[model samples]
Target: MNHLKKCLASLALSLGLAVSSAAAQEAQKIKMGVMQWETIAMTSSVTEHLLERHGFEVEEVEFQEWGVAFAALGKGDVDVLISHPDYAAADYWERNARKLEKLSVASYGYNAGLIVPSYVTINSIDELNEHKEKFRGRIIGVEPGSGMMRQSENVVNEYGLEYEIIEGSGPVAVAELKSALDRGEWIVSMYWTPSWVFQEFDIKFLKDPKGVQEPTETYVWLAHKGFAVQNPKAREVIASVFVPESALTQMTGWVKEGASIDEAVARWEKANANRLDRQAMIGNQ
Candidate 1:
């Protein structure tokens, strides 16, 4: 009877230790929200690698819509996300501002607006109307719910331009732009910088004289309201990362030329090995 009681006590202690160990592991795990955009993917990949190097596990949660992603972060379903709060995700950020926290600026000088090939004579949004007939009375745009498209709609209404904004996915819009450029036809489409298209084509953003669209934007690292308090170490590592506009554009161009996200990130990591090594050692001390 004494032996049996001792055996039972030992089993209970072991089970308690196992549960505690699992809980500790869970505490060190992070859930990252990822969008479909290439830049977001690249940033997420870089962040994941950095966090892993510092002993944190990262799991990416894919989101198809901006609103959904923001809501998930607010509810704590995701721990972090790379976002453009000032411009691209302004609406979503405003809606969920109370539930999210900005950790750091991931990149700077992200610009978005109407773009035209270099051969086009127009230089500004106001000039777009003058060449409406040449542009076929339409403005090519990306996904319907995207911030760029919403702002593009505002541009149309604000400018009072008589043209239809064609809604489509990013790839479709890019395909349309390429096709128009190949035919040497006049085409104006909503586009943003740090995009691969800039590398592939000689295009420029039309001047936004009325300022309906933000001329310069910043991409930021965002997290759930209490994420910083719960994961200070991870936050420090995240805050330590900052990719310049030129480097981001170069990596994006590489991805556009057939490199996978992993490959692009690997190349970027190799190029900045010394800086990354120091970044990884951020909270270790």
Candidate 2:
């Protein structure tokens, strides 16, 4: 009877410990807000799944706009967000400064630039002014609040070009360019790197002699203030997620082809399993 009592007590304690560990892991899981735009679409999803495989639960929230995503992060409505540094006016950083304090390292080292389809006859911004009427005197633009849009505004203002800015969504802008190109029509507009468009289409960067957009941009991951305290393990893995420009372009291509975000992510994960550990040690966005 004494031996049986001792055995029962040991079993109960072991079960208790197991339950406690599982609860600890659950508490460390993350819920992230994702933007439909950007190369991070595939990368973040892949990172989220990888974290889940290691015992974290990922809840993904899709926001209609980048501003909404930043607001959600600042209000602690979400646990993690993949942010763009050179987006419309340090939106992510400003939100972080307001309240959200936790920020992981950046994931890519790249810059945004203005590009045109290779079929474009003009080679420079000055040249555009001369042949502005051939392009219907309109400059294509992405969302109304995008960084490139502002840069395009500056370009037109500085050059004194007689061009009207067309406002549209990111995907729509890409489609517009494609449609125009299909008919061999002339078009000039804002464009950026680390995108599937660059991978699949031959394009040219117009000379920004005025240097309105002075520098290149980087991409980053940010979390709410208490993220580190609540989920140190998740913090470690999230900080380590990153990929090279080449891989980023590939993922973007996968997305442009209509693969779901998760599908694109799985493709990247399978192709780059060996790089997961290296991703943890990568530095410099």
Candidate 3:
């Protein structure tokens, strides 16, 4: 009877320890917000792998618009968001600045504007108004609430374009552009850098004579308030991560062609192993 009591007590203690260990692991997990855009998706995927190497789990939550993403961060629903808030999402960041903090700029030379196939004769935003019928009187745009889409609307008004702006999700807009381009059909789609479309297709950004589109912006990672203090190592890794313009476009191009996020990140890691190792080394220091 005495031996059985000792055995039972030992088993209970072991189970309690196991549960506590599991809880600790769960608490170390970091939740990150990501948008549906290609660049953001690829960056988040790579960062997740890097964080895991640092013994931190990453939970990537996809948000549709900048507002929703910032809101989640502000409310502490997410720990961090990988984005270009300074340029593309300036409005949302301003509104939620008090609730969040900008950690580091992860990417540079980011750009977004109107683009057309190389086959299209149109060279500038100003010319679009004259050939609205050629583009079917429509400008394909992404995420209704995105700064890009808002600029697309302004382009229509400022240029006196008689075109309709068709707004959809990022992937949907990309698909529309692909389908149209595949058919050699005319399409003036709102597009940006680090997208596979620019690399995979013969496309060019239409000249913005009116300077409606911001040029060559930087992208940063934003964290919920006090996140840096709570996870200093993770914060260091986030700050150290950097993707050059050429590499970024290539990775996103793969993702644009149906490659899974993990697959794309894996490819990038293998190709840039030295660079990644350097980043990890810097973060550790």
Instruction: By TM-score, rank the candidates, best first.
Output: 1, 3, 2
Shift in Å, residue 215, candidate 1: 4.0
RMSD of each: 8.6, 8.7, 10.7
Candidate 3 lDDT (Cα, 0 to 1)? 0.82
**Which regions of candidate 3 fall more than 4 Å away from where they truly are?**
1-29, 130-147, 166-187
Report the lDDT tens digits of candidate 2 across residue range 254-280.
877888767777787888878874654
All models: lDDT?
A: 0.87, 0.73, 0.82
TM-score per candidate, in order? 0.83, 0.75, 0.76
The most accurate candidate by TM-score is 1
Prediction-by-prediction clash tally: 0, 1, 1
Using lDDT as the yardstick, the better of models 1 and 3 is: 1
Candidate 1 lDDT tens digits, 1-285: 999999999999999888676545445789999987777788788888999998888999998888899999999999999888877788899999999999998878788889999999889999877878999999999888777888899999999999999999878989999999999999989888888788889899998889999769888999989788667778888998887777778889888889988898899989999989988889889
lDDT of 3 by residue, 24-116 (tens): 544478898988866777777778778887778788899987788889999999999877666677888889999999888877878888889
lDDT score, candidate 3, position 22: 56
Q: Candidate 3 — which pairs collide?
A: 196-253
